[model samples]
Target chain A: MGNAFKEESTELAKKTAPADLMIVAKGLTKKYDDFTAVDGIDFQVKRGESFGLLGPNGAGKSTTMKMIGATSLRTGGELTILGKDPNKQGPEIRAHLGVVPQTDNHDNDLKAWENLYIYGRYFGLGRKFLKKKVEELLDFAQLQDKRDVKVDQLSGGMKRRLTIARGLVNEPEILMLDEPTTGLDPQARHILWDRLFRLKEEGVTLVITTHYMDEAEQLCDRLIVMDKGKIMAEGAPADLIKKYSSKEVLEVRFGSSKNAEAAEKLKHLGDRIETLPDRILFYAEDGEKVLKQIHKLGFEPATSLVRRSSLEDVFLRLTGRTLVE
Target chain B: MSLINASIDSAIAIAERRSGKFGAEFYAGRTNAILERAFLAFKTSSWMIVLSGFVEPVFYLLSFGFGLGALIGGVTDGAGNSVSYAAYIAPALLATSAMNGAIYDSTWNVFFKMHFGKLYQTMLATSLGTLDVALGEIGWALLRGLAYAMGFMVIMAPLGLIPSWWGILAIPGAVLVAFGFASIGMGITSYLKNFQQMNWVNFFMLPMFLFSGTFYPLSIYPDWLRMIIEALPLWQAIQLERDLTLGTVGWSTLAHVAYFAVMIVGGLYFTTKRLSALFLR
Candidate 1:
């Protein structure tokens, strides 16, 4: 714990002094009636960092993001965007921060391109500049094919992309996305992630919230795992896995529920044992060695597999719960 | 001077100076955007606009002018001036339609944009302040009210309800009435949480439309009730439009116009403050 504090403060100091610290939140908090949605927390994101908030449902990630976006007022603490207080300078702060909300609330009355055009105009952009910016953003979000269509007529993915494009109309310095790929298919999710990566490479700061551990692993330079309005753990994906879990995980499934109970009796052979409804997960440095020992115990499980431990394992270890729960 | 008084005086000076520039440039920009959107909505939904704004006024004209006017012929106005029932009621319907259209757009449409559509949220995320949004929305309401008034005027031209060429100026007068109501409605909308509360606007607007000299002149009312009705904003607007359209202009006409002017300025001040607190805070 002492070492962790030292490292965290050092990181915080480095973040505070960076020339491009676009977003900063200090001891931020939010409460709705009796329930505290976001507990006191502090963090910073540099200009080009792809930061993430990884947690399951009801984890306060959305509340934290909304506060930074200047849409939700903070109950306590200080928050700054581009070195301006959001309380007094909300319009100015928001002018530099692009936000894609959790849900697609595109104007049904406007066409796909008009959504971008009108939003640009609201930012006080001239008509000629907004027209050109709308075209460029449509191409960037890959919504050029659906530019003229009414928002209500477009598919879900198309609408989501157009909303993302609309946020960029002001040419914001920081971009925040809440659950960007929550309901997308595998192909669509990969495409969206690819676009986000391209944005990251262009030196745009990104702050994203998601429950998908693999997504955090793929996209985040650093992330915080939140639970019940508090930060449980924070680190880079690789470092978190190394600190909380073993290098490999072994999965053993018995032929019947009765057999699975028998296999659990031999859990002392692994570093950590987790019993699921049908399978038993064994965390160990050498999954193959642990599997051989289990085989020698005459368990003869129905199925067996071995794979490297992932951020899912780290999340489960830190929160004492699975991500899917 | 004390610091507090000094700050207050400086604030007032800034407001006075900025009001002139912001009022014209900002409202012009906002009014332009709102007019564009209203036109686009009308272009796509022309039938709805025609049915609501045009047909509804005509229906009111037929029902109250010929049907109800027969029972209440040659009513005396507040100034004890006798006029034909149709002439008295025509301007009232004109004012009522303007108020109804403006209030409907400012409250229902603005509420939807604020809550469900999240349109204002998106707009505020840009450089547009809360004042810009309020001005834009009220400007749109005024434009819609202007269109309805113009259409009503054309219909009245052939009916001989229009008494003189000066009646042409009543269209813009009706728009000022709409702007006052629309600005007040925007302020009321910022306080509302759901669609259920909006019915209260009708509670106020409907009574004002019916008893505020819309059908018969206020002289028909008891003295106390007439005084109260005369103080209502729509009553003032209707009185002005009636005098202008019926060629009965007098010094009281300036007071009627001043009433709407006060409502416009005071309503806009409160509405912008409320909107800024609601959206920007």
Candidate 2:
């Protein structure tokens, strides 16, 4: 025990290393009345790592994010963000964390610039510093021309960018994004991803929750697959796929669910199979090999496509469903 | 533990224990943001401010004091003194005006911001807390009430409705009463889910304004109703203002002031707590 204690103390002394863990949650839970929004779940995020909670709409991703952001209280267990308890040290913890909620919620009463300035002031930033930062953030968000425009007039994408910029005004060490690209167009999503990549390059720890498997594949270094308020699997994107899924996926689409059942009859050719409303998926070590076996089975799917197994396949293997709505 | 580890552990413990401050500061900052936004709204819609603050009060003074006072003649108050109906009702109007302004700002403005505007949710992301938001909103309500009171007092002074320099004290008194109502109204707004229940607030306020000795004296009511009227904070404020304006100041005036002071403090405490719970979550 003394040797273990000595080792732990030695590890604790090296905490100044920039990549130390920034968030720690141990059996954190959130209950609203009798319904459990977030069941007791544990996770840790290291500094500079882009972590994701990948799940469907009702999988409690947002609830968990809210707990870490200090916007919502935990019903049981413990959570610490930036080495501070969210319940007691919320302000101090929040001071070092930026959060972009699922909705816009921008100040419609103030000009876009004023909204940034006022929010900066709330974080105890000086007026002079905020003025300069506001200008820079406006330019960063590409809203320099719309600084004087009311938030009510800005487009959804512009509002989202402004919200992101507002979160960054305090120069937070950890940024929590709750479905950052949920309602954005493809162009807007790409723009937002580019900006997020920049933040990651700056060594900012990011915690994002999204149901988009493509987004998880593109952005997350490590992710947790959640379903029904529980973590189904967790690891680096590639690692999780290697662990729970095959190397490739073969998609076979037919006329309807009944036709998809006929395709499922050929499931023995692959490691696993998934049947959807309008399509069927075969998970196997090699997609081309699986397709050859399907051809030999005399099952002619309306359309068949071979692709690399992704986080989507991992989600399906774990939850028996697709991530998309 | 080593000294450095001990210090770091202490810091973490302190940070954890002090988390509530973030919620508090975020709310306070939200309130300040709302005040700033209200000022911006005032700048853009200057006409609304003028109409609500100046024109409306002046219109009430002229129509009631000059128009309605003529037919009603002088009436006796609870003090057993005869005064012009305008004089009796002017102070009451002043009290009610403050109540109206504060309640309007706190309820309608706060409800809209809480629900439709989603302003508090935006502010919560920052360091501002719920109490900060409540206080900042009440502060603005008080400011609007003060402005209206100043305009009302100016009109009252010129018409000789105010009998003594002591009447000027009613301005701050009006603001205090306004703040009490505003803070309590904010507390009430937290529980209200939609605009439908707001009509209930109007239903309660309209009767309170009319029957709280604003247009007449409470003494005209039977003993039981009169007792209930006296128990109300607005009635106490109106009585205090009327006595001060009429130069009939007495020990009962202190009790009236105490009533509003208690209301201000108590209302603010609960409002801040409720708002913190509502927005912080």
Candidate 3:
């Protein structure tokens, strides 16, 4: 029976590229009691691809990531990681996956190197292998100087970096990062992004969940934007922007009281207009032309600027709400 | 196949059946890794925490066994042999030492690791299963029990408290005692919601320690109360260890071992179930 099953799986793998598809989910769902955290959702991730789940808090991005990471069981779905069911083969699947959770959970009593070393041990890695792996990862995280220092003494950014390094100790085939840069300063975020970019260059499959659109655009090869436990859109960053947003955006502010009124008068000036409490945004192929038309309409804004479209606009367009709020 | 290979295969088959009965995601059979992590963490932890478990019973031995035993004089052991109050209470203190070590690690330590440390979350994210976690943690607690047992035996043997060659068996007896308490304590800890709820473990423990014939004989109590005290795990542990050290081994000693064996199995079952429910879901 085992032999027959193995043959059948081999035949199935032959139909695909065998290793090309790293994760596949069809009608994935997660419900906690009466509340559904993730409605039925479907997506596929290819090998070596940097995939993103972009959504605001409680949008089921983390839920979906957990299912893919094999730490959570889906309520209803056909979800597979590396051609194995997560619910049945969670430990086997997790053996090849690195997970960097939202918060840093280091063994604070242990040294930074010991943290990496012990995490490697959890994967059943040999002491000899982890010895070199720990040193290499410490260097990768740029924490060689803090190797012997206790994790509790490390700075916030350093702690985060050590956590990331600890996750990579297994040299996982897929690295799942849940909001990897949530509480970091800009410099720390940039450093982390650079490290992640280097890993991507090394052909490690990256799965990231972030509300930061800039991080999504910079890291993700393709992504799914989620809202209210459902996927709003899925595409490459540029493709998604092009499909759902205009080429450029014109920002005009006429004071908080006048912003809504100004948006009504300037509605015909651009392809679309979204009025916020403090400012009005005009989406048009040519932002400069929209600004000029707004001036011709005899309503001069206190402040005006023209810039290119971004994933933030696409998210706002799909969800009807800003990412941070 | 060779006998060894055949037995090994059957063992694996049994394990597979157990995993299937529970859930396949729950066992990777790599509990040693979890033990390694504990030791690595322990290297830097304050030794005073461990010393406290060993010291509590010794202090109890010095105060109640030496100071109070002076007034109480001799007491009748389980085997109907009249023994000194010091020798009589020493074995019970050893059993309490084992219980203290096991309970400390499985309850308070496990609680901290579960809530604040997020250690289990970190471990679960890896390939390790809930069974690996349950067994590994309980095993560590058992080791603490073993350490305290050995330390107390060293004190007991030299003070001429241990009266028989069978007293050496108490080391392994301590392991069994520790394993039972560790498993049940870990299982019960999973149901606790907060630090305030954790105090309930200690609340039950203090009375059980005092009344389980640790410092005196259970015959002092009425028949119903004596039976109630006998049913408690601490009494079982005290009975087993005292029998081993005092040369009072009997059929009831086997009953005490059986009691803890049941606790070990039940505790493991509940602990694994709770771990998967809390984390995997």
lDDT, residue A315, model 1: 78
By summed lDDT, the worst window of 10 consecutive residues in model 3 chain A runs over A8-17
Which is the leading candidate under lDDT? Answer: 3
Name the lDDT value of residue B165 in candidate 3: 93
What residue runs in model 3 are displaced by over 4 Å at the alpha carbon? A1-17, B1-24
lDDT per residue for candidate 2 within B15-99, as digits (tens), equals: 2343333343334334555577568766765576557655765677778877999999998865678888888788888988888
Query: For candidate 2, lDDT tens digit of each residue in A98-214?
Result: 889999888776789988887776665656766777888898799999999998999999999999998887777788999999999999999999989988988888999998888
Error of 1 at B94 (Å): 0.7
User: In terms of TM-score, which candidate is stronger, 2 or 3?
Assistant: 3
lDDT (C-alpha, whole model) for all candidates: 0.77, 0.80, 0.86
Q: Which pairs of residues collide in candidate 1?
A: none
Please give me the DockQ of candidate 1 compared with the native complex: 0.21
Best to worst by TM-score, what's the order? Answer: 3, 2, 1
Give the true-contact fraction for every prediction, in order. Answer: 0.27, 0.38, 0.51
Over B195-258, each residue of candidate 1 has an lDDT whose tens digit, in order, gives: 6798888889878888887876566688988888878888888888887888778899888888
